[model samples]
Target: MKVAVLGLDCATPQLVFDQFKSDLPNLSRLMAEGIYGELESTHPPITVPAWSCMMSSRDPGELGCYGFRNRKDHSYNGYSLANALAVQEPLVWDYLQEQGLRSILLGVPQTYPPRPILGEMVTCFLTPSTQSEYTYPAALKDEIERISGGYILDVENFRTDNKQAILDQIFEMTRRRFRVAKHLIAHHPWDFFMMVEMGVDRIHHGFWKYFDREHPKYEPGNPFENAMREYYQFVDQEIGEILSLLGQDCAVMVVSDHGAKKMVGGICINEWLMKQGYLRLKEAPSKPTPFSKVEIDWDHTLAWGEGGYYGRLFLNVKGREPRGQIEPGDYEKVRDRLIADIQAIEDPAGRGIGSIAMRPEELYRATRGIPPDLIVYFGNLDWRSVGSVGYGAVHTFDNDTGPDDANHAQHGIFILQVPGRTGGHNHDDLRVYDVAPTILDLFGVSISREMQGKIIR
Candidate 1:
């Protein structure tokens, strides 16, 4: 079986099917030709933990990941491989390698410092802030260096506050990735060909308004989002083209890690945390002259928030935490207490909001990969968690500008976008996690006895 896994960051199952059911004459036929549905994710259904779990087949807690950030050792300043390293448990690739099957991974996150990668890979999504050493897949340094353009690019650099520019950038990257995918697939005969279209998520965050055309943030005449109906069409064309090249007998599967949805309103969790005595922002002393801004004592700051990504409540464990306030054997207790407190937290006017929090135990049960150091749930997160995120302050600053428009916010309610799949979509929905085990199942590989998720077949 040859599976083509298309991971659209923050793509809701419905978004995928709804936008393309008829538009994608190709994928629609593929659906009839195979299996499809809304796939449920473990709780605290954020990306970092969810994607990692899908790849590794291990629960979040065991994988040692909390969110995109390693709160235990660092803050959410940038992506770090520290947590990835802690995921000593084996991955789907390891099993594939042992079985002598080759696979291809494109632009997947947390797979960086990519080692033990079973097949050919080109590292991606490596941000400018990432430590040079942490971004490269140590084993494939030569391959990455050989790519026409290095494996990593400052993707956000292509983004802009203008929707058209953002769309152009998305298409540009998509083209680059398509070419790369073709190269890898042709150069190496592989069992699985996986692609993560980071652009789709970026597009959703910046253009969810396009889908509805009624939100306060909606932009008119913004060619990209306003014409988003074509985005999926374009992607479908890409899929059709890829399919044309595949062997007819191979079974095909299209999977997205998480679905995307438009954000309702911003929640100043840190601001809320400050009111709850959970976070304290260090004050800047004396107004500074122009061109010279004040500094943030990241070291001294207590409980900071990083925009919409994880929607997490990270406690600064060092100097700022209440002395002995959260002690040993009480991690779960503190976690529960935090979740409860955050749940009770209300917006300034108190009109009943749609968010919740999670304890380590709840978080532990919620996922099969690294669990966030702290569990935070936003709004109903009907599917269990909010979408992607970006860098921003607790309350101020209008990220309505720059790449901030594309700052996270994709994953949401979806597993499938069928007439009956809407709210009822559940374990019954087509799942992305099932991709690995299903392939393993077909090959006669024992689904790892320790696997948290079940076989797709």
Candidate 2:
């Protein structure tokens, strides 16, 4: 079967699977035609990295990225796809081409300067925020532009989700994305065709509350909330259209790196560090830290996870941390103390923070080469985390009453649908890494031995 994979980043199967099967006639038909299932993703399940795993069939560490930014010590900058493509690694397209199979790729995240366009590919997802720097073969540019209508134009006006005008922008963008998808599929015919929708991820961050009962800003059918769901349905309809376009002799695979949920509260590790004396700040330093300004004592602070999966942790180390003050031997003690405190602490209303603090070994078995010193699993409340060390307050109150019964914490749930069945989500399901291997498997391709993922089929 010719495989066409569509990645809906931040889409939780649980949230949409049953709903789509019951409400979306087209999707239900596809489920009946082929295999489908909920795919479990990697830990700290954020975007850039998970999608990278899908492309490379390797863990982010092996691929050399854990999130949008590496966040080593205090260093920060976004990861680019150029570095990834240079690894001499065997991507699915490359493997398929060696075997003489043609493929087309478009909008796959963490992809840049689209290379080895066996058929035709336009890298739109994870595009540069400011300008277009397409890497597809020159032969395909005209075709791409013709179909895409001169590349995706970012919406100009910015309005909060609560505003109707902004909601309109979202609706327009969603339509544009589907238009591009249909046009591309119509213009190409190959063994494998892949596309990813980043709009889902962005919309979640911008309008998570409407969907989550626990969000402080949630207002279901709130114009923004309504718009988000409507956009999702629109995507479903688009999927139906794409399947129809594919006809027979092709199998449709839909997956997401992770899903969206609310973040009701967060644990500021920096604050905890300050309280624990692991970090010290001068009333005024001659120079400010990276995140700190002259007016803001940024020496020590807490944040929700800043990178991969938004669930990472790091310590301000002696040589690594600019504001490091903790003793080397005490790193474990500090982590233990914070983990204990965070694991047991509750929100202002008396709710536990995380279920528990897990040692790196205890949680993510595949470190991907560099695991954090600690892994924390927050309870059903919204999450706030960071992957660095510092001092300041550890816990703070975030206000947002959720939907009377809307589910709050669901970033890591499993995607279970007919035709494909994997165990439901658990901390151990690292299926996101399996994405790359599965794509390759569909084409009977092989990967390097150093790669960490296995073939999903």
Candidate 3:
């Protein structure tokens, strides 16, 4: 069976079905033709682990990756940015290759330093440069550049105030990526083909404030108010082109790693921990500093948090960390206390901010790597956690990276279309892990026992 998977990063089911359904004709037609649903993403719902989990059918713990940054060692501070090399589990493509099925993979995340596959592979978002050997066999890189002008890995420097420039770059990037994809589809022979469009996620992050009417800072008649809609429409056209290239026997599936929503603001997590006496700095720096840069009094510190789309808290256990403080016997006691306190944290208005706190072992199949003591979704995904300290206040108006306007939501989009099918099926219980098993089943391959997700069919 021929299968084509199109990944629209950060696409939301609510926005696609409920709000902008009229704007996306391609997606709408797919939903009517087959099955569609709200697919639940990984815990914290960040990009790195979410996409990896979908491809491997393994939870974060089983995959040994939590987010973009993972603990390099068991020390209190050491961390390395996660990439394709960090993923321990075998990818679905690896399984397909074992069956002698040739596949083409393009622009999937955590695929940098492209590995050898049965067919061609152009690495994903983390590719350092087009000048680098981003494609398998190396020579394919030159051919791709000659065909599409150049390989567009991703839109660079997305955190600028210039919205129009960012939009233009996303458009050009999308166009080039699709151009290359069409070329490969037409020329290259393969049983399976998959590519992810990252422009959707970039647009959401840069323009959500303008698109989301519910945002407090939104302006009604803003020039870029309809930017998101226009971009989706453009993406729909691209999807239509892709579908037209495929034969009637090919099955199609469209998905997203996670969804996006308006970010209210950022919570200064390190400062809040300091105020609660859970964290102690040797000397409060005049300027905001990252956790790694500051001199921490580990003996006095009980718990500390690293900030991102959500907060990752680590406990100073006596034996685990170098300057450990919390005893092994009291590990549960301290963890429970911290979880309770984090759940009870309030907003500036004195209203309780509803948050979900979880222990890694309880949520995933195994806690392989140095797992966080507590994983928190601040204000339940509305407010991001700021890792920088010495902000003085508990809240901020912008992201530490730059002027990002959106945060990750729990649900993403999933649509599967089989030819000659009638009466569309809608599944509300789909999870990201289910995709891998379902895809394997479609190609007549056995789903591994290690995979936690069940086949949708």
CA lDDT for candidate 1: 0.55
In model 1, the runs with Cα more than 4 Å from the true position are: 72-86, 116-118, 127-154, 219-225, 281-306, 315-337, 347-349, 365-373, 381-432
In angstroms, how far off is 356's CA in candidate 2?
4.6
- Candidate 3 residue-wise lDDT, 345-400, digit = tens: 88888888887789999999997777788898989989998999878888888688
Lowest lDDT sum, 10 consecutive residues, model 2, at 399-408
Distance from true location, Cα of 207 in model 3, Å: 0.6
What does candidate 1's lDDT look like per residue over 1-457, in tens digits? 5555666656566655675468877677666555567665544455666766777666567676665555453434434454355567777767878988887877665665555555665544643333454322454444443542544332464435576776777777776677667667667777866767676767666666665655546667754554566777887788777777766545555555566554545555544555566544454233211111233344543444444444655555543343323445655666667767656645445655555665565545444332344555555542122221222323322332233332333233222122222232234643435656766766577888677666753
What TM-score goes with each of the models? Answer: 0.77, 0.78, 0.98
Weakest lDDT window of 10 consecutive positions for candidate 3: 419-428
Angstrom error at residue 233, model 3 = 0.5
Name the weakest run of 10 consecutive residues (lDDT summed) in model 1: 382-391
Q: Between which residue pairs do clashes occur in model 3?
A: none
Best by lDDT: 3
When sorted by lDDT, best at the front, the candidate numbers are: 3, 2, 1
Tens digits of lDDT, candidate 2, 49-154? 6666666676555555555555433432322343345334456777777787887777776566556657776665555542455646766666656655666534
Off by over 4 Å in 3: none
| Candidate closer to the true structure by TM-score (higher is better), 1 or 3 | 3
The best-first sequence of candidates by TM-score reads 3, 2, 1
